[model samples]
Target: MTPRPFSGFEWLIAWRYLRARRSEGGVSVMTWISLIGIALAVFALIATLAVRSGFRSEFTGVILGANAHVTVYAQTYNDEFGRPTRAIRDFDGVAERLQAVEGVTRAAPMVRGQVMLAANGRNSGVEVFGQRPADVQTIPLLAEPERARGDIARLADGVAIGQGVARELNVGVGDKVTMISPNGVQGPFGTTPRISHFEVVYIFAVGRYDIDRTRLYMPLSEAQTFFNHQDTVDEIEVLVTRPDDVAAMIAPILDATGPDYFTWTWRDSSGGFLRALEMEDNIMFVILSILVLIATMNITSGLIMLVKNKGRDVGVLRTMGLSEGSILRVFFICGASIGVAGTIIGVVAGSLFAIYIDPVFGFVNWLLGGGVWDPSVRFLSALPAELRWEDVAKAVGLSLGLSFVVTIFPARRAARLDPVEALRYE
Candidate 1:
């Protein structure tokens, strides 16, 4: 049996040191604090990254859902003459040509402009989009028939408002709202906004404030009449078969629409929101990584203190034929044990917290009594979490790697203990 292996004994001693109480010359208060700190740092980093990833995912889906993948706008959106000089005159033909383009799943004409919505003695600024309700492709993702309290089919004859708008105005389906177009007919009276009232045939919730709180749908003919633009359309909305292929699909779409038309993807028109999210995620990662780095340093300090406390043990072990290499191995096991345990627990706890985030927030809201994740104030009704294995892997790897690297200093110091000096004091 060769009296068993020295590695096994070293691990045995390390495990004992971790489990021993202060009365038995075991792990100190600082060691426990360091262990807990590292675990918390890992937890915070993992949960925060998950939150950021979830936001990006939610926002992207909302953007893609509420709007077309690509839009072929006239050369210039508007001209100084208060007229859309490049308005698509041949809307039907342009839509037909665009639909024939490769990668284009669907094409339809759309009109959008800012308007003031007044209902139930309340007024709110709103964005109006004119489209034929018969074309299901152009409707918002959350504006499905299941969620609507009124008839979505009436969009062409009446108006469809968002849930937020309905709430703010305290109006429901069958209510009438006045829509005043900002771009109205110019007259000698220095221009007056064109106002029209329509029955609120539908109320939608797009899960986005910009669209839900400020968006309305009307019939193309009504919009044309109100905006004083007839026999033409503002733009052509296009849906792509594959969202990722939007950039590639651009060339063919532009060619099909002719040089007179300008094509813009959803990403292009998101007002730099996509780039801002990426930048925010990067910045947050770096900031949280710094916190994690500080926590890892505690492992080194704890190991150093443990080595200083166990100097006499090293001498006795060396006298019993233990080598300096074995001494180093013992300390490595001690320090690495804490790191490994903390990392494992952190991963499990953090993952569970992130994955079940909805329930967690629900509990919080219940305890705090509202204001936890209000949809009116928050983009989502509950906190969103999208856990990425890559992020978890990076966090675990960094913690374990740093723990290993930190052990070298204290382990080397313990291994260098002079047996003679250590024994003379005893």
Candidate 2:
């Protein structure tokens, strides 16, 4: 009797053919090679994309921590003070309205101005900013356990500076410094610059060299008096619960401030630098996909060899009434099994490797002698990696699809064989 149509006999034969020794028509060597090649390709593809994502995440976190997720500025048409710079009037109401918006965690008014920071005899131009005592502590990643945390509320008459600024000025905690304002009041003598002496209270170690070099923080009330804005603020700094949600939060904030005021997110301030990095990542993903494609090509070659070696067996099976479809299923299973196994191995290996790549790279570096990455030139001390599950799924799907497609040609070739022609020399 003919065999049942949906029986698993074809799968059993396919698996047996795969396990057969080289002397028995199995391409055993090629099978191992295909498995190994696919694993390397998957590992490389996943690890490469993960490292790029990690770098992007690191940059975004550092930038957002140092800056507000969004900033709002008011453009005043008329200012009683002739200073070219304008201030947002009635900012307390604006701050309250902003705090009420959904997703906005905090909204604080700040005064920002250019001031000269003077040490013993040396002076450096710096940007001075003023925040409320409670507000000052909210700056992102502003403090680290490596450095001692101090109370900004106690800094009633003191200034907080970045480490780079302190180094450049040769100042330290408790060292006295003078801040000079260029926009001074007109006195009986002439235009006199406003000078104020302050004790250094806290030092912010914000990792980024640029932020550390030029930012000085003080109380908002003191900043208003120094900048001559008694009842106004330079701008409103806003922090959202999620940095990624800044784009959506901009509209509601603008509604609260009316048309004259404008809002900008971190994306707006970051400009092309961040956008360019994203483009680079896309390019890398495309480039790495080629490696996986090349690896899948090995599956085609191995499957083709198996078909050629199994020609005599195919003729015998056909002569015994095994249909063309059954013959095709057997070979299809053989090829697909290899592809699935390799893809699974790749996903598991790639994920583990990317997650701990820094340590792996460190070991490799040690083996090859130190200085593989120069700290002076590279911003990150270690390689950062972030594996995305979607990426793994994409890689696996492409590999399996290619494997199944390659099987069709070889299986179809075997199905079309004439029993007499295939078994003539058997």
Best by TM-score: 1
Report the lDDT of model 2 for residue 320: 90
Q: How accurate is candidate 1 locally (lDDT)?
A: 0.81
lDDT of 1 by residue, 241-282 (tens): 887668899899988878888888987877498899999999
| Tens digit of per-residue lDDT, candidate 2, span 1-426 | 766653688888998988988999998788888888888888887888788888887678777877889999987566655655558888999999999999898899999999999998888888988988788777756644124334455567698887767878998888999999978887898888999999988887655556667888999999999988888898999999888768888889999878888987888988577899889988987787788778877877887899899999999999998999888888888878888898889889889988888789989999999889753354554567888888788778877887788778887887888889998987
Clashes of each: 0, 0
Deviating ranges (above 4 Å) for candidate 1: 1-6, 76-84, 136-140, 143-147, 182-193, 372-380
After best superposition, candidate 1 residue 248: deviation in angstroms? 2.0
- lDDT of model 2 at residue 76? 56
Clash pairs, model 2 backbone: none
Q: What's the TM-score of each model vs. the native? A: 0.90, 0.83
Best by lDDT: 2
